[model samples]
Target chain A: MKKKDVLLKALKCAFPYTLPILAGFWFLGFAYGYLMNVSGFSFVYPLVMSICIFGGSLEFVAVSMLLSAFAPLQTVIMALMIQARHLFYGISMLDKYRGMGWKKFYLVYAMCDESFSINFTADIPQDVDRGWFYFFVSLLDQSYWVSGALLGALFGDLVHFNTKGLDFIMTAMFVTIFAEQWMKEKRHFSELAGFASGVIALVVFGPQRFMIPAMAGILALLYIFRRLVEKMWETGEDTE
Target chain B: MKMTLWQQAATIALCSLSTMATRFLPFIIFRDGERTPAFIRYLGRVLPGAVFALLIVYCLKDVSFFRYSYGLPEAAGIAATLILHKWKRQMLLSIAGGTAVYMILVQFVI
Candidate 1:
C-alpha cells in the first residue's frame, strides 16, 4: 500500500473507536474551558494547559491550583498524585509501544486515560499499521479535547444551554469500557479487585482524596494475590 | 489570580513535568533488550482491567449520595449504558443513550 493509503486506512480504522471519546472529550473539555474562563483566566490558559497537560482531570485541578497561591512544589506533587495511574498505562504499553521510533515519545506523552484505553484494548486489524493506528487515536482524542477547550473558553457563558448532566458521558464511557473488558477476560479477579478497592477507598478516603489510596490498595492486593492470580491464568480454568 | 505570570508558567510547567515523569518513568526504568521483571510483566497484563474500573469510580467520585437526587441520575444513567451496551454492543449508541438519559433525568426528573 502507498504511504497515504496506509495512513488513510489507519485513520479510517481508528476514527470509529474514537467517536465516543469525541463526545466525552468535547463536553468535558468544554466544561473545563468554560470553568477556566469564568474563573478569571483567558482562553489561552485552557488552550495551553489542554495542549500541554492533556490530562483532563489534572488540567481541571490545575485550574484551581492556578487560582490559589503560587505553590509550584504543590502543583508538581498534585500532578504526580493525580496522574499516577498513567504509570500503570505506561507499564502496560511497554511492549506494545516499543520500537516505534519518534512516535514513541508522543505516544507516551499523550497516554491519557482515553487514549490508553482505546490503544490497549482495540484489536487493530493485522494489515493496519499499528504505530499509525495508535498515533491517530492519540492525536484525534487530543484534538477533540483541545478544540473543545478552545471553543468553551472563547464562547462559554455567552451561548449557554442546559448542559447540566452532560458530564455523565464520561462515566458512561468508562462503564461501557469496563463491561467490554469484563466480557473479554476469563477470570474476574482483577476486575473485582479494581472495583472493590476503588469503592473501599472512596468510602474510606472520601471523594477528596481516594485515588492514591485506591491505587495503593489495588497494587497491594494484586501483589498479595499474585500467586493465586498467576495460577488462575496458568491453569486456564476460567478460559471462555 | 494571586500568581504572577511567571508563577503561572512555572506551575503549568511543573504539572507538565510531573505528568510526563509518571508516564515515562516505567519505560525508562525497564528499557529495551533488558528483561522486564516477571512481577511487572504480570501487572502489565492484569492492570488494565483494574485501571478501567478505577477510572469509572474516579469519574463518579464527586457524586453526593446523601444530598439532593441521591445519585439517582448516575444510577439510571449507568443502567441505561449497561443495558444499551449489552443489548446492542455499540459504543457510541450506549454512551449517547446513557448521556441523554442522564441529561433528561437531571434536567427534568430530578
Candidate 2:
C-alpha cells in the first residue's frame, strides 16, 4: 500500500470519534464562557483562554483566582493538582503510542478526554496510514474546543439562560467515561482498588491531602499485586 | 460595582492563559517516548488514584462540613449515590437520584 493511502485511510478511521468530543466541548465551553462572563470578565478573554490554555477545570478555578492575586506557587499548585489526573492518563497510553514518530509529542500533549477516547479506541490498520488517523483526531478535537469556546463566549455574554446545573457537565463526562471503561472488561479489581485506596487515604490524610497519597498507594498496590491483578481481569473477555 | 470592559478582557485573558498553560505545559516539555521516564511513568501509573482523590474531595470544597452544613445533606446524598453505583452499576440513575435527593433536602428538609 502507498504511504499516502495509509495516511488517508487512517484519517477516515478517526472521523467518528470527533462527534462526542465536539459535543462535550460545546457544552463545557458554553458553561465556562457563562461563568467568565457572569464573573465580570469579557468574551474575548475567554475566547483567548479557550484557544491557548484549554484546561477546563483550571479555567473554572481560575475565574476566582483572577479575582484575587495569588502567588505564583499557589497558582502553579492549583493548576498541577487539578491536572494531576493526566499523569495516570499518560501511563495507560504508554505502549500504544510508543512508535508515533513526529506526531508523538502532539499525540501525548493532546491526550485530553476526547483525544484519549479515540486514541485508546484506535486500532492501527496494518495496511492503512495510522499517522493520518491520529493527526485528524488531534486536529478535530482542538477545533471542537476552539470553536465551542468562541461560540460560548459570543452567546454567553448576551444571553443569561439559567445555567444552574450545567456545571455538573464535567462530572457527568467523567462518570460516563469511567462507566464505559468499567463495562469494557468489568475490571472490578481496579474499581475496588480505587475504592480501597481512597478510603485509606481519606482516613489518613483526611479529605485535603488524600489525593497524592491515594494515588501512590493505588499504583503501589497495582505493582505489588500485578500478577493477581492480571489474573483478576484475565477472566473477563478483552474489550478487543 | 462595575468592571470595565478591558478589565474583563484582562481577567479573562489571564484566566485563559493560566488554564491552558497548565494543561498544555508538560505535554510540550516532555517527549511522548519519555513518558516512561521515571517521573512521568510514576505519574501515569497513579493517574486513577490521583484523579479519584481530586474528584471526591473537590466535590466537598464549597460547602462547610459541620453545624447545619449543606455539605452534610449533600454528602449523605452522595454516599447513597456511591452505594447505588456500586450495587446497581447504574451511573446515570445514581447521579440523578443523588442530585434529586440533595435538591429535595436543600429545598425543604434542610
Q: TM-score of every model?
A: 0.97, 0.65
What iRMS does model 2 reach?
5.2
Off by over 4 Å in 1: A237-240
Best by lDDT: 1
Q: In candidate 1, residue B17 scores what lDDT? A: 90
Give per-residue CA lDDT, model 2, range B24-109, as digits (tens): 45555565545346644544543443354345444454456556664666566666566667778555565555555655666667
lDDT of 1 at A217: 91
- lDDT by residue (tens digit), candidate 2, A1-240: 777777667777777556555655777787778777777766776777766666676677777776775345666666666665555656656655667777876676566655765566455667656656777898788777767766776776676554443334334334444544555554566656766776677667775466667677777777777667566555564644
Error of 1 at A70 (Å): 0.8
Clashing pairs in 2: A6-A129, A7-A129, A10-A133, A49-B16, A53-B20, A87-B44, A88-B47
Please give the RMSD of candidate 1 to the true structure: 1.3
lDDT of 1 by residue, B15-69 (tens): 9999999999999999878999999999998898899999998998988999998
